[model samples]
Target: MHTPADSAVAIQGLHKKFKESHALCGVDLQVRQGEVLGLLGPNGAGKTTLVKILTTLLKPDSGHVLVNGWNVTADPEKIRSTIGMAGQYSTVDGLLTGFENLYLIAKLRGVGRRTARRNAEDLLARFRLSGVAGRPAGTYSGGMRRRLDLAAALVGSPPLVVLDEPTTGLDPESRLDTWDAVGELVAGGTTILLTTQYLEEADRLADRITVIDAGRVVADGTSDELKAAAGNRLVVCVAEDHQLDAAARAAARATGVTPMVDRRARRVEAAASDGPAALGRALTALEDEGVQVLEIGLSRSTLDDVFLGLTGRARHRAA
Candidate 1:
């Protein structure tokens, strides 16, 4: 068993309530030191509440909680000092230059004027914001502003960073840029609790993922482990859109599972119990039905499948 001493963040029997809504119910979670832990859940899944508690923004009704070896309720100030938070919305002032934002945050963290300036400069360089550091943050692109916000969060070199959907509403290119920035943080051994709607982001960055639903953790494991437990996937692509129905039926028949159809991709996928054997059967069925097959394969399950299996929300190609 792991103790709070060994964990970057730990909670047991955590509960939170708001009016008649039970936001979190007996939720237990742990994030190891130096690991990126992806906190995943649907909307109202207590993700934000849990983050709030961990970051000292909110208190849990009843539970034992610790961050960086400090009790959350007893040492809320200490916990706050060790955590850096970047939420979905940009928090930087539009009127301030990127350097000013970071510098101000550094000063707020209680560093001396000289140290604060140095810290701001270092962070800007670290996050690739130095070239535009002098420009007003309002003039920065979405991705640049996000990078700036992230830089401000690191001003004091907090041990743990909490990112609550750091890439929301970003264009595809901007999203990729933010992912790269997060990757750099992971490489530097920062413990991160990241909550995101992008399943792919969790799959790419998280050393382990904790899935919560209805205010409780339903699954916790590495990406591969979660995907493996979800079962193998049988995928088939048809050459024509009209053949999609036939392909889906063939996959379902072979895998003994309902298939998910993606019309634009002309693809049908489902969980398969027998892997390669199911692929063979699917191939035979499609051939017999004269459906032109573009691609067919049996592979390990993706994070998308794991998410769908746990949440029961088939958000096709979850953004």
Candidate 2:
């Protein structure tokens, strides 16, 4: 029997549906205590539905979900009590000051008035929102709002935090700040279930990743494991625009596969098992053929590459 002392989250044969469309099909997942698990999928891939079920906002059609070792179906309140949620959009109250928002949540969670004030102040400082704690959340910048939303979720100090695309619309600086915050949360022994569109984010934060497509799990593994499954490749960029075809020929010859060319980027890419060695040979071949190369690099397959290789579709659009 599963217990709160073991896994943070455990699911088996989970299924959910909307009208005739099935959202989850026998989905099973496990999140180790104090580990960050990245849940990845394209839009409309049942990610939202599954998160809802875990948060006790929606009921699954069938199967079992245990959160913090409490069955989601049988002891929803117990599960809910241990979970903190930060959704895709900011849930901060626009009219309320940052400190007020967190203070309110603390009080609502049954904290004493003095303790609530202390917690709110501490969270504001921790999230780098102390400077803006007196400002109305509506008047805050995008990054500030996101930080406030995240801080608010931790008011009760829940053991499991569910972050749904927490950095979706933030600037690079803000995203990094959020990443640091997540790291701190984990360092403090909090487990996180993160769903995100940014492969880089998952690659950085997750100890393990679970990928779903069309409402079904397509892959699950560590970032390196997933990348290895996608395979390694060489990327070569020619100096002169006219040298593109020559570079492509070199890449193909070195890798024993037809190289893909991007004319706009003046680049040629091809899969290579030997990575650096293949890239070295490809460069030598290009040099011998008098193809002036501007730049070249060998890269292992990335999470984006893994998603493309598995789902045959781009996960994130240019935004």
* lDDT agreement with native, every candidate: 0.88, 0.88
Instruction: Give each prediction's root-mean-square deviation over alpha carbons.
Output: 2.7, 2.9
For residues 1-319, what per-residue lDDT tens digits would candidate 1 score against the true structure?
3687779988889999999999999988899899999988777788888888888889889998889999988999888888899976899999999999999998898999999999999999998999999999999999999999888777788889999888878898998999999999988888899987678888888999998888989899999999889878898988898888888888888998889899988889899978889888988998888899988888898887788889888533335
Q: Give the TM-score of candidate 1.
A: 0.89
Instruction: Provide the TM-score for each candidate, comma-separated.
Output: 0.89, 0.87
* Winning candidate number (TM-score): 1
Candidate 1 regions off by >4 Å? 236-250, 261-267, 280-296, 316-319
Clashes per candidate, residues 3 or more apart or on different chains: 0, 0
- Clashing residue pairs for model 2: none
How many angstroms is residue 130 displaced in model 2 relative to the true structure, after the best TM-score fit?
Answer: 1.9
The C-alpha stretches of model 2 lying farther than 4 A from their native spots are 1-4, 236-243, 246-258, 273-298
